[model samples]
Target: MTEMRYTTLGRTGLDVSRLCLGCMNFGSEQPWMMNDRDASVDLVHEALDAGINFLDTANVYSTGESEEIVGEAVASANRDDLVLATKVYGDMREAPNGGGLSRKHIIDQCEASLDRLGVDYVDLYQLHRWDENTPIEETLAALSYLVESGRVRYIGASTMSAYRLTKALYTSDVEDCSRFVCIQPEYSAVARHEEENMLHVAEGEGLGVIPWSPLAGGFLTGKYEREADPADGTRGAASESVRSYFTDENWAVLDAIRTVADEEDATPAQVALAWLLHQETVTAPIIGPKTSEQLDDDLGALDVSLTEEQVLRIAAPKQPRYPES
Candidate 1:
């Protein structure tokens, strides 16, 4: 395996691996989940052995089972050596106060997440989404309290409009509350929408950009051809979320990716990840691998270097439209 590279997360002093291990598949919430505790633990160990010190999970993932699995995996490893991150803002229960970014929900979920992860303090605590129902001030104040109380070291946000993120940052500055240090946006070769707004915001603010679904739910892996149905056992066979990428525009993107992958003598997955790795604004791209073999292939992205022209070829299908300020 190639030597893992590390970078300081955004402008912070905290160092994290270039590829964050995503723990969303560690639990059995979905049919596509690995759903094997021993295998999930082994996968975590594999990542750790490969020099990945960053792990990203969510409290709502498998209703906290993913965190529990992660906690179990790290029990044998040194906690101080890893940068653990998880999210909030998903409905955990059916009743009221079940979820949202309100002060009560934020405080309550932080405790529950800490317990599930078996950690006193999480390295990064992110709001899974923007809760329009709650005031940004209330959410930031609660997150700031967590930081002051030492329950969370840093706060982040995910999957929100650029305006909302900017507002949150402004509110934090004015209220003297903990601000978001990073963003977890859905960015990949097939999904370039964030490049228009969120990426620009994160770059301008010096915030870390750790993108989720960097492979577009495996669409960029080149497993599905243009005129054929997805094979059984593949995500596309059962997941509408994965099939959603099967548009004409995305197929062109995949074609460009395929050409680049052939030139690099690498797998489509590695090339897809390499594209993200080459972006100046991206701090890390979360890799969700269900098995050790997949993880090994993903780790190979560090060694796959792309020329300037090759990068443009892969990105030519979708050009980002920057909004005039």
Candidate 2:
């Protein structure tokens, strides 16, 4: 096994593993989900044993089943040593106040998530996405209460525009609310849009960057071939999100990653992950592996060091831009 490395989450004193185990696949929400309780729990244990101490889940993932699985998986482990993170902002019920960053919903969902997680407090609580319906002030104030009440240690945000993020940070400072210590964006070799603004803002604000879908929804794994349909039972065949990556432009990027992987003697997935690890602004990349073998393969990226040239080569095909021409 590759020796794991740790780093502080952004400017905070909280230390987390360089890779966060994203628990999105541990439930029966979709056809592509793991859907097996024992297997999901075992995978979490395997990741923990492999030195991934940071676990990221959300209230909406599998309708909170992911949290239950993660909670049950870690019930025996020392909680202090693990960074348990989760997010809010997705509807849990069909009722009016079921979700969003509203103070009422945030407070309610935090409690619900804690209950499902079988914990008193989450190490890091985050907003799953920007809630345009709720004022940023209201959201930050509610999150501040979570911190003051000892139900949450730190707060973060995910998948928001750079302008909104900057405003939220400014609001937190002026309003004396708990500030965001990190930001989660959909960043990968195949999806460089965040680099045009989101990443720069995160680095400037000293926020930890934990990118979701770092493999471009499995496109960067080099499992799918050009001019061919995805195999049965594969993510590409089952998920429109995965099939969306089948563009000539993205294929060009994958070609570069394959070339680098051969040179480094690493798998295409490892090469893709290593590119994120090579970035100075990235604190961790969330790895969502459905199987133990996949988890082990992702961990190997820690040992695959790419030269500056290799990193640039893999990134060169798809530079950050808005609305590709």
Candidate 3:
């Protein structure tokens, strides 16, 4: 295993691993997810052994089964040494009060997630998505209460627009509530939309920027061929979201990534991950691997260093195109 690297999470004092272990595939409640209890637990152990101390999960991931699996897997490890994070705002139950960032739901879900994870407090409690229905103040206040009550150490946001994120940060500052320490956005070699303003805001505000789906749902891994369809049981074949990424533009980006991988003698997935790791603004990129082998490949990213020219080459094709020819 390569030497695991650690960095400060945003401007906070907490030090998180450069690669966050995403437990999205830990439970089998979702048909598309393939990991069973034992396999998922084994992956967690492998990640820990490999020196990863940060784990990310969501309450709605496999209907909370992922948290249970993670809880059981990390039961033997010292909790204080690890950075455990989970999200709220996803509907765990179908009831109106079962979801959203409202104070009721945030408090209820944080307790429930704590119970499922077998931990008293999560290092980072995130809003899975922005809930427009609830006032920003209400959400910030509820999260602040979590921090004050000792159920959550820090707060974060995921998958929100620049405007909403700025507004939320402003509200937190004005209300004297807990400010978001980090932001999780869907960013990858093929998906560079967040580079426009979200990344800038995160840099300006000193918020850690952790990107999920850094492989573009497996497209950047060089698994999908140009003419052939994605293999069965893969994310691309199973998820419509993944299918949408199979466009000519993304394919070109993949080619660039492949070239860089070949030059570096690394896998395309590793090269893709390296692109994110090399960014000054990125604290970490969430890596969700169904098997330990995939985890190992992801960890290889820590060793794959891209030069400034190589990084630009990989990203050149992703530059936005306005009206033209």
Candidate 4:
């Protein structure tokens, strides 16, 4: 971790870790049970010790058990030094008013999230995903109100269309509301769809970009090679969200990435994340470390760098066959 680095979060003037630890796996140990309190605390402490100032979690992760774990971790960490973040706009429950970007649901979820996180405020409060039914103004105004109340320090949006993101920014400017200053997108060596125009919009607008699934949900870790059937219990094999990165084009990209990893004397995971950090517009690569060993390897990306040619060789952008159209 000698060469660990960070990047500024858009116009917020916050310096966040180049790699933000994503906590969606929290309390998801199996059999529909959340992680025990002690193990959760330990993971948070370990990440902080490794200089990971950024942590990303959401209300829907583990059906809110993830938020409880995140809350416990933050209390255990005990600091305003950490750049903690969490998201909303998910189906918090089965109730009609339980979800959406409307003021009622947004505020309700923010309070619930604050309670779950056990914090006075979160560094960055993000909309987990877009909601088209609600007007963008309603969402922005609600977030602005949160800022005014000091419950949320800043605001961000996740996995939104370029059109919506632009509209939100303009609406904020005109209405004097809290604007989204960052974007969270599913980006990886094999999934680079965000690069098409969403990322370009973020850069042009000076909005920070954090890429989720930086390893293509562990497909870039080299643990799921062509010859090796994915580990039986691994998330990728089990997850409906990430099965496609395993396709043929991604396999070619994987081979190219592995070659670079060997040349740099770095782990494939590390090389993959470094490639993400190399992108001019990417502020942070969201990494999910299910265990201490995995966390350590992911953090090692802090010291890895890819040569320009090495970067180009693996950046087969055309691979995300189902483009973000």
Q: For model 4, which pairs clash?
A: 27-34, 27-35
TM-score of each: 0.98, 0.98, 0.97, 0.94
The lDDT per prediction is: 0.93, 0.93, 0.90, 0.83
State which candidate has the highest TM-score: 2
Worst 10 residues of 2 by lDDT: 316-325
RMSD after CA superposition, every candidate: 1.9, 1.0, 2.1, 2.0
Runs of candidate 3 exceeding 4 Å displacement: 320-325
- The alpha-carbon deviation from the true structure for residue 127 of candidate 1, after best TM-score superposition, in angstroms, is 0.5
In model 3, the number of clashes is 0
Report the lDDT tens digits of candidate 1 across residue range 162-186. Answer: 9998999999999989889999999
Write down the TM-score for model 1.
0.98
Give me the displacement of residue 111 in model 2, in angstroms.
0.4
Q: Which portions of model 2 show Cα errors greater than 4 Å?
A: 323-325
The model with the greater TM-score, 1 or 3, is 1
Q: Model 1: how far is 114 from its true place, Å?
A: 0.9
lDDT score for candidate 1 against the true structure: 0.93
lDDT of 2 by residue, 1-325 (tens): 6999999999999999999999999999888899899999999999989888999999999999999999999999999899999999999999999988899999999999999999999999999999989999999999999999999999999988889999999999999999999999999999889888788899899999999999988899999999899998888999998998898889998999999999989999999999999999999999999988899899999999999999888877776785433
